[model samples]
Target chain A: MEQLKKAIRERGKVLSDEVLKVDTFLNHQVDTHLMAEVGKEFALRFKEDGITKVLTIESSGIAPSFMAATDLGVPLIFARKKKSLTLTDNLLVSQVYSFTKQQTNDISVSKDFLTEDDRVLIIDDFLANGQAAFGLIDIVKQAGAHVSGIGIVIEKSFQPGRVKLDEQGYRVESLARLHSLEDGKVTFLDETVSVQS
Target chain B: MEQLKKAIRERGKVLSDEVLKVDTFLNHQVDTHLMAEVGKEFALRFKEDGITKVLTIESSGIAPSFMAATDLGVPLIFARKKKSLTLTDNLLVSQVYSFTKQQTNDISVSKDFLTEDDRVLIIDDFLANGQAAFGLIDIVKQAGAHVSGIGIVIEKSFQPGRVKLDEQGYRVESLARLHSLEDGKVTFLDETVSVQS
Candidate 1:
């Protein structure tokens, strides 16, 4: 978490008042060493939840989900953003609106992968409006699987995603939470009020 | 390699004569233990290249790239499949045609992560027509980086991908190469031809 926060402060660029560009280290280009540490932390945090599978959306969240699966010693299932020709009919599909892309796309996973006996731990890179996480949770529910907990690398706490998930009684843990980015200063959410970026 | 072969034989479904679906353990749902072994195998194969980075395309390739990076103790840079508003102007882009999806798309990478001094090892989940690998190699070339080698989990030698790559003089190492999938038998091109459903 410290390394991630440090990287955020060093190489990450703030595109707008909303978007944080971590292509240098976090999402596009990954620091596997730091990711391994973060994965271990997630597993430790949700170790007692009886997680049977690690679920995440495609593209960005794949690395963290894979790392978490490795650390947790469980299988990882990622929802592909596009329905490829290889996809079968026996799939649990859900539509997710991407605020970044400004488009609604369907995410899917085979029904054979998830069953009632499985407990899923949802993971993602960023949790903004919580649309992606909500979509994933919806698909998991469709499979009759219990949501163990949600793990995220970065969370914009001011954005109501955590509040909504909390309202649904799902335990959510984020490594770094951003309270506000007013005046070009990143004010982090902690009792100590640490300035990250 | 044996583990992957066994997994494909056991859980992989032959969707068609050409497509082998190993989503149960390779792409959609990942087996972390097998991936670790895959990483070691890739490390062993490209051990002499002094690989500075593990390069891959987004989505499916991230998992094996993570494992390979962990084994090699290097950075992993995955080329994103789409252009996002968050991406910077400085980028290396290439066009790729997906036979399965029946569409062509541009893949891009931030110019900062890849450089002339970097020696990259490209990794992927499958090498069917080799279009994806070719696209990745083009991106690496655009960045003036050296592609140390290419490592694939499964190579359908029946396709033109390997021959094209070989003609281009890229050293390709595939863990399991399939000669043919005629009828219900899957014939591997190894010393011992094995069959799988």
Candidate 2:
């Protein structure tokens, strides 16, 4: 978490006081070493939950989520984004709205992978509006599986996402918590204050 | 490679004579342990290439690609697909046609990631038509970087992809080579015959 926060300060591009572009290392061009550390931390945090599977949405989340799954020795199920409106009986679908992209995508996972017997850990690159998390939660519930915990690489704490998930009784673990991205400055959340949440 | 061949024999679902789906492990729902093995194999195969970067496309390719980059002690750069035709000056773009999706996607990578001095190892989940590989190759060339080698999780040997890459003088190492998927059976290419290629 310390290294991630340091990387954000050094390499993260803060745009328009609201957008943080970590395309350099965190997402687009990934530093596998940092991601491995991230996976180790997430696995250490959620290993006690007896996680049978790690769930994540495709593209950006796959790197860290796959690493976490590797450390946990579990299978990783990545939800795919569908361009078409087609629905099948064998799949569980949910709509996720990305604030960054300003678009809604249909994310889905096959029902064959998840079951009531699985304990899932949902992992994602960022937790902004909780839209993606809610969508993944919907798919997990549709398959009758329980999400034991949620692991996030970056959390925009200035946003209402973490509060929303906490209100729903879901425990969220984020590696780097952003206090604010206001005025083109990267600010991190004080851990002592946020650990209670 | 033996385990990968066995996985293809056991868990792979043959959709048609040409289409083989390993969504159970290779993609979609991923087996991280197997992917870790895949990463180790790719790293071992390309260790002598002096690879500075491991290139892959978004979604399915990220898991094994990230692991390969991790083991190789290099960075993994994933090219993102753009739905819109808008191109930026600072990005390198290429068009990739997905044979399975029946769609053409514009895949782009940031210009800041790759440089003329870098040696890239291109990794992908499948090499059916070599469309994605070609697109990635374009981006690597645009960056003035050299592609040292290509690594594939599964290669559809019945297809002309390998021949095309070989003809282009690119060394390709595939973990599992499929001879054919005809008659609803997964047949692997004999190593003795394929090693000559």
Candidate 3:
């Protein structure tokens, strides 16, 4: 977790008060070593929950989610994002609005992947407005699958995502919790976790 | 490689004469253990290429590509697929047509990730028409980076993708080479790669 926070501080760029670009290591381009550690941390935390599958949104979350899923020896299911839904019978779908893209994208997973017997661990690259989390949770509910918890790589704590999920009674864990990106400075919400070496 | 081939034969569904749906493992629901083997296989084959990075398109390619990059101890950069190009000056962009989706997507990589000094190994989930590979190669060329061949999880040899890349003088290594999908049966061009127990 400390490694992720350090990576964010060192390589992450603060473009504006609301946007933090981690293209160097976490978003566009991924640092595999750091992700491996992040994955292990998530696995360690949820090892006792009997996670059936690791669910994440496509693109950004796949790397860290794959690592966690691999560590847990479970299948990793990434919900596909679509501009619009086809209203298919065998798909569990939910709508997610991205503020950056200014669009409402439908994220769906096949009904064949999730079942009522399954327990899912949701992971994502960032937690901003919690729209993605809400969508994923909605889809999980549609499948009648239990939501074990939500794991995040870099959480923008200044936003309402964490608070919203907390109010909904979901346990959330994030490697890097950003307190603020004010004045082009990357500050952490909880810096108690020391960097490993 | 054998494990991958086995996965294809066992779980891979034959959708059409040309289309093989492998969402169970390689695409939608990823089997982490198998992908670990795939990453190692890619790393073993391209060990001497001096690859500075492993590149792939967003979504499906990210899982196997991340594993390969991690095994090789390098960075993994996933190109963002956009409906249309933003025409950014610092972005290396290429257009790829998807036969399945019937859409032309603009895949772009930031100029910051690749340089002339970097040697890149491109990896993808499927090599059907090779449009994705062609687009990625073009992006790499635009960045002045050397292409260290390609690593595909499944290659439809019946399609012209392999032949085109072969004709272009790019070394391509596929884990599973499909011969045909006639009558909803998946056949391999190279089942000669025995399954590892």
Top-scoring candidate (TM-score)? 1
TM-score of each: 0.95, 0.94, 0.94
Q: Where does model 1 exceed 4 Å of error? A: A191-197, B191-197
Please write out the lDDT profile of model 3 over residues B1-197, one tens digit for every residue. Answer: 67887888888888779878787887778999998889889999999989999999988899888778998999999999863222245888899998878889889999999999999999998899999999999999998999999999889898999999999999999988888889998878765465758
Arranged by TM-score with the best first, the candidates are 1, 2, 3
TM-score of chain B of each: 0.94, 0.93, 0.92
Q: What is the C-alpha lDDT of each candidate?
A: 0.87, 0.89, 0.88
Candidate 1 share of real interface contacts: 0.85
TM-score, model 1 to reference: 0.95
How well is each residue in B39-145 modelled by candidate 2, as lDDT tens digits? 99999998988999999988779988888999999999998886322224588999998776788988999899999999999999989889999999999999999
Q: Sort candidate 2 into its docking category.
A: medium
Better of 2 and 3 by DockQ: 2
lDDT of 3 by residue, A29-79 (tens): 899999888999999999999999999998789988888999999999999
lDDT of 2 by residue, A65-91 (tens): 877898899999999887322224588
Cα lDDT tens digits, model 1, B160-185, are: 99999999899999998988777867
